[model samples]
Target chain A: MDTAFCPTCQVIQPTTGNVDYFRLFSLQFSFSLAVEQLEENYQSLQRQFHPDRFASRSATERRLSLEHVTRINQAYQTIRDPLLRSEYLLERLGYRVADPGQSEPQDPAFLMEVMEQREALEAVDLSAAGAAQQLGRMREETERCLEQDEAQLARLFASCLPAEAGREAVCAPELRQQIVRVNHRLRYHRRFLEALDQAEENISEQGV
Target chain B: MAYNERVLDHYENPRNVGSLDKNDPQVGTGMVGAPACGDVMKLQIRVDDQGVISEAKFKTFGCGSAIASSSLVTEWLKGKSLDEALLIKNQQVAEELALPPVKIHCSVLAEDAIKTAVADYRQKQKSMG
Candidate 1:
């Protein structure tokens, strides 16, 4: 029974989605990261489990390699973007963000502000140079919003993580509430970026 | 997944595609957003003194399924008594629309909109009294 095959060794590493991404990447579990080091580690891991390296290994070993590679890719994706990283951190802290069941409330005044921005974005003349400027402006505003949220997220996580590094992050009710609000607003930032990208693509396709 | 003809038909020719004056005493407004997909829906109904819904309107910024769901509910709400409206479940909307599993959230949103609208109306009536 060849039941003890691991991609790295005889030890089976935890799966990416289920485990802490920092642990998955063999990095310290903090919001701040040395991106170059992350990239280097990712490349090294990918090279080690590149499937070709496991072609002559046992079938179980090959399967394990594939699983590791899938997890590695997923972890990389989750950690690559600040918004996604913040979401992942919040998730690890046991909040589902905007889960339908939990349905957290957002500030109505803030929502009205976002809606007005959307209306302005909708009215942009994509055929004109002003379109690019308009999109850029909105994108900047969204990025600013994201940056502010990320700062808040980092502060919240920093406060919680140091006290309980060995166990699940001990989330205060205030932290939970803040995380939910930030996560909800993060959707708007993401939507703005997506909309901007689509508009830009259509404009480029039309050569306008 | 490819939308079936009925879903597409509803999407293309949506019913009650407008807004109600939310400030109006007779009107009840339910505005909901699905944080999962970032879809927002606004559903409104005008209830008569006898508690019958006489008019319904909806405006939704979402996928075709969500739009169709809101549209279908508006049509259903027009002739429904408040009690009947309260009883209309999301499953009924899903069944009527032939919504696939992935689109079930849209139906849920529709049902929620109805309940919220009723709740809003009741609150307004209470405050008035």
Candidate 2:
């Protein structure tokens, strides 16, 4: 069996080892991913390759079943997470992300932007009555940024991969750079929301 | 599985759970979050021009392990040089806190917070130049 091909069935098989999540499962990178549909697909795959289902099978068969199940789970997880999915896409296109220990020096412009946002967040007093409303506006702005990120991801998916044909091509360096910026912004936006949530919780507790 | 006693202690009673003034030239803030588990940690350090971390504070809205990790790092960071603080590894934190494999990432996040806080300070210095 070619590793690129879906290992579960005898359809058009791509080879394995070098296969990515996008290739392993035919999915368009979009916000339109239906949770119910995903669950259904996962359940069907579970029934097919779950190790318990193959408990009486031969050793090789059981091993294969276990491997397939792991791949399915990995695929599901990667697709379910927008950040992970973006990172995986970058990896598939041959970008080397810095290891957790290694610091990838970021662009100075991006750092300045981060510093400015952090400063803005800190300067606002969430303890004040009007601060929560201001933070709520920030949250809305962040949500809009998230939507833009999704749109950019959709564009990347549409441009990088060929429709019908499964050939993989390297994404543009410029595009990859944009993706990294968006990833960083998304990280900050998430933190901002968490901080807002904590403030709101405190406000409710104080009954003010 | 039950959390380590030390981790539980920190989680239940996190140290330095507050924010510092980001506008203050002496204060550096690092906010990081992992969307995977919906964990957010904000670490702030007051650094003098000498690059010494005089005070460290953190506020984390995460699991018990994450709280412990941040709390522990805040304690370790005070009085340390920015360089020394960045050297704090997730493994050591996890070991001291006795974090299980599943909670290792929380420790990693704390280590990241330290590095990020230092980096933020460095950026401030660079801009001041």
Candidate 3:
């Protein structure tokens, strides 16, 4: 049987066995991950398992170092981003939700809202005296929306993984719907920020 | 690292970068972004009543890879049926643009924008009906 060796303990752990990555790392599935905590974990892992650190080891130890490094990188990438972590959880549950580039259905009213926001951004004239002020208001509104969405995501994560309950309530359909809404709002906020950046660039270029 | 030169060329001179009137019933707008990189892309396609993409345009605020990805998709989506356009994948975009492994997500974002924009349009049509 294929096994993964832990770089820290030098223990050969079976990959096919029951070793939950999230559980091992003591991370909850939520948008509230502290970046500093993640960074600390990554640094610790790098110190222990990075290939350069294992250069003087035997051939098997070197192979294990590479494998651990790959897993550490993959875990870091997933845990660092809220959206990716949510998507990873969904995928782990056997949901075949396509990435944003896939042809999944989206809500129409949400799209309409996106269009309206785009129009509002385009209409703001940076040449005007209050254009920057207006754009700032828009940016504030977008940031508020993002904060609200993140709060909702925290609630969703709690509901899906209630500490009182066991793993039985993990994959509810409502949680899936909530995830989709978070994804949509996240997309909108990103667009608004981009528009804001473009407006600022234009203002600077014109010496406004 | 210097990105693939071809990818850089497309990014710097992104073809079909602009916008269509979203208020137009025939136009569908797909807005997508990566929060991690703070990159945002807006893609719009004008579809005829027959559901064929008559025109495509985009406005992307991102790194060179993202701009190139959306620009390439707009050119690829135009004149194709929505169904055919949905079939476009990140791998194809990455392969055509020769994106490095690290930048492959840029193509993925572009591919998503196309599907999303088309889906947004179809939803509008359904509500109207």
DockQ, all candidates in order: 0.35, 0.10, 0.12
Displacement of residue B94 (Cα, Å) in model 1 is 1.3
lDDT of 3 by residue, B1-129 (tens): 787887878877889978898888789988876544546678999999788998999887668999889989888897899999999999999999898877887898888888788888989888889
Write the residue-wise lDDT of candidate 1 on A96-144 in tens digits: 6535444456364555455556667767888887787778888898789
Candidate 2's fnat? 0.03
Ranking by DockQ: 1, 3, 2
TM-score of chain B of each: 0.97, 0.96, 0.96
Clash pairs, candidate 1, are none
A1-208: candidate 3 lDDT, tens digit per residue: 1245557885544334344445435555445676777787678767767778768877877787787777777778877766666666656555544443344444556655665677788778888889878988988998898788778776776667645422533658867777766765765676577778888889888883
Off by over 4 Å in 1: A1-18, A55-59, A97-114, A125-129, A163-165, A205-208, B48-51
Model 1 lDDT, full chain set: 0.78
Taking chain A by itself, what TM-score does each prediction score?
A: 0.83, 0.68, 0.73
Worst 10 residues of 3 chain A by lDDT: A12-21
- Candidate 3: true contacts recovered, fraction: 0.06
Global local distance difference test of model 2:
0.71
Mark the 10 consecutive residues where model 1 chain A has the least summed lDDT: A1-10
How accurate locally is residue A43 in candidate 3, as Cα lDDT from 0 to 100? 83
Over A61-98, each residue of candidate 2 has an lDDT whose tens digit, in order, gives: 67777777888899889778776766676666676443
